[model samples]
Target: MAVTILGMDIGGTNLRSGFVNDRFELSEFRISSSQAICGEKAPENIAAYIERLMAETGIRPDAISIGFPSTLDKARKRLLSTPNLEGLDDMNMVERLENALHIPVYIDRDVNLLFLCDCHANHLTADVIIGCYVGTGFGNVIAIGGEILVGKNGVAAELGHIPVRGLTLDCPCGNVGCVEMIASGKALKTLQETWYPEEAIGTLFTLHASDEPVRGFINDLALPIATEINILDPDEIILGGGVLQMDGFPKGALEDAIRLHARKPYPEQALRFHYSGEKQENGVIGAAILAFRHMKREKGQPV
Candidate 1:
């Protein structure tokens, strides 16, 4: 029998959910406001939402997978911190949801799920892959041999938080000098408002491609990526996010900057870069894929 999986992507702004079958067909897609659903008694509210989804579709899920833009514990059972979703920190989401739905539940950082989906869609067969997404903030995920690498502290691959000297801006993570402070969409917006007040933020890259400050910003964006490449030497790197997808964003220039800062000789020359386009369904699809894989592994079946 084909497995039916329920996948949910909980973002800062929206909560998206969908059902995926074994053949990767998606149906019953729904989107809702994150804030409205995360009210007091959030766990109960989320469980009710899932129950309603199942009742309406008449298709009970074999397993549930959720992706959150937050830090999770090593076991992936509890959320360690959620900066955007207030009152969700330290919540035992997996336990609560599983108890309510009477099904297995799995959870992970949203970026990891996105990387999983991108890899599967791109047919990237590399044993080691790194995904760097420059969205509202810098999101990163590292996979080795098709499995995510969660360090002992369960906070591995936090490429965004890598400190950069001389950058004094405060990061939402309560740290100063983090690379994300100067290289993410938030940074670009600040620059757009400060330097090009008359121009729309979305068109900043298209209008000022040759501006020195813009070039410097692009360089800053590539520095953390190159640093990761030098440290991990992964077989392939996937770069994407809202920032890169902006109108007339300089993809080639960013690629060149990454190569320029990457280590000379060896891996730099051998590196394979894949740029993923923005997909609204990627998060939900990724959650389903991860859940399917997790279920198969638990059954001692080959994936």
Candidate 2:
């Protein structure tokens, strides 16, 4: 049986929405500024926005799924914290949105949604996998034995916050010197603004591929990734994000730097990796996948 699901990838900057069917085909994808609908009561704003979009598009979905950039509670009901987005802290979006929309609602970390999209798109099946996305911030997720690995508090796979030596940069998540402070897209933007303001950040790799600053930035990008490789030594790593998808980004150099930092003999020698190849609507489609899967499981259908 065919069914339509409404999926959204909500970020600090923008909101992406789309309709996805059981076949995993995405349609009517749209992006809008997140701020336009944000207010003191963000849940209401989100509900209203969905209502308006669905009314306009005339696609009333069987369920709604959202990918939010926030840590979730152990039960995946309440949002623990949302550093980048405002008006979303400590909210039970599942209850609120379901009440407002009168439909089944599902939510998860945005990167986990990205991981689902990566696996579905690439046809990857493995016992352990790590997804490291370098976008506005460092996003990470891990799967062990074919399940998303959530810690006791449901905030596992926060590899971005792993400590770094010889540095004391305060992170929004608190504490000092989280590797994200130096290894993420934010770090790269800082590097560009400091040293090569004349060149666009997107073109930094193309123009200064051999420059030390750019080269070092790439090396830092490898730091957290290599550290994860050292620890988990995942069967496959799905690397993706806006930074890596940019024109002229040096994928080879980044991979080499990762290998350079990886440990010897064990994890380094036989490491396998692949790119996520994510598209603009990848998260949106992944959200739908999550909803559809949940629906199937409730009906005792094989996923």
Candidate 3:
């Protein structure tokens, strides 16, 4: 029988899980709502969720790996904080889950998981890759030499909260003018409400080629990418998220805008663009990769 690892990706709205072998071939992928938990009930409900998944799959996992949309602590043993998911912040997930399940648990910020996905899926040659995903929110994950740049607090890559133009918009993290507010799904909604009051989101891209307001919103959102590029100068930049998947979206326009704002010396010439397509399986795949890597590390092996 193949040794399998269980993986979970916990987001604000969705919780995704899967099982995979050493090669990252996923099996028994499942997605469920995050509404099953509230405050102190989260650990209990999360345990139930994992048990149900295992029961459904009939797979006894060798280990468990989880990705949280939050900052992990210095030791990677505690959940330090999460700007979006309030209940998970300051929670001792590593200890609680490991004790509850009798399995080793590994957790990291979700953006780092995205970076792992991009590296494996794209077969990127660059040693340093920066992944910027703009969706319901914005997130960043930076990896150098095939390892994550986990800082002292494991909160190194909070790239989306960096202030720009001091523009104040209400952010879920209780901050004003966060990069997410200016560049994320919320930003898209704000722009739609302000400029294209009569248009639907699915059609915004299609209409933008001719509509002034839609065009303006796209350009405005592109500014955040410009800011990130100017600072990080990543060896390779991967852009993925829901907004980029819209029909008739102007891919060339966004790339050109990014290039225009990036530094001329390196980032402009080496910038790489990738759309994650419309598949919802990315989270599951990423989760699987996380588990596979962790299992290898624990076994005194290399990934």
lDDT by residue for model 2 (196-216), tens: 888888888788889999888
**TM-score of model 1 (CA atoms):** 0.96
Q: Kindly provide the TM-score of model 2 when superposed on the true structure, using C-alpha atoms.
A: 0.96
Q: Model 2 off-target regions past 4 Å?
A: none
Alpha-carbon deviation at 195 in model 2, angstroms: 0.6
lDDT of each candidate versus the true structure: 0.88, 0.88, 0.75
Ranking by lDDT: 1, 2, 3
Each candidate structure's TM-score, on Cα atoms with residue i matched to residue i, is 0.96, 0.96, 0.92
Model 1, 173-269: lDDT tens digits are 8899999989998899999888999989988888897798799889999999999999899999999888988888888888889889999896679
**Candidate 3 root-mean-square deviation in Å:** 2.0
lDDT of 3 by residue, 28-61 (tens): 8778886665465777778778887778878888
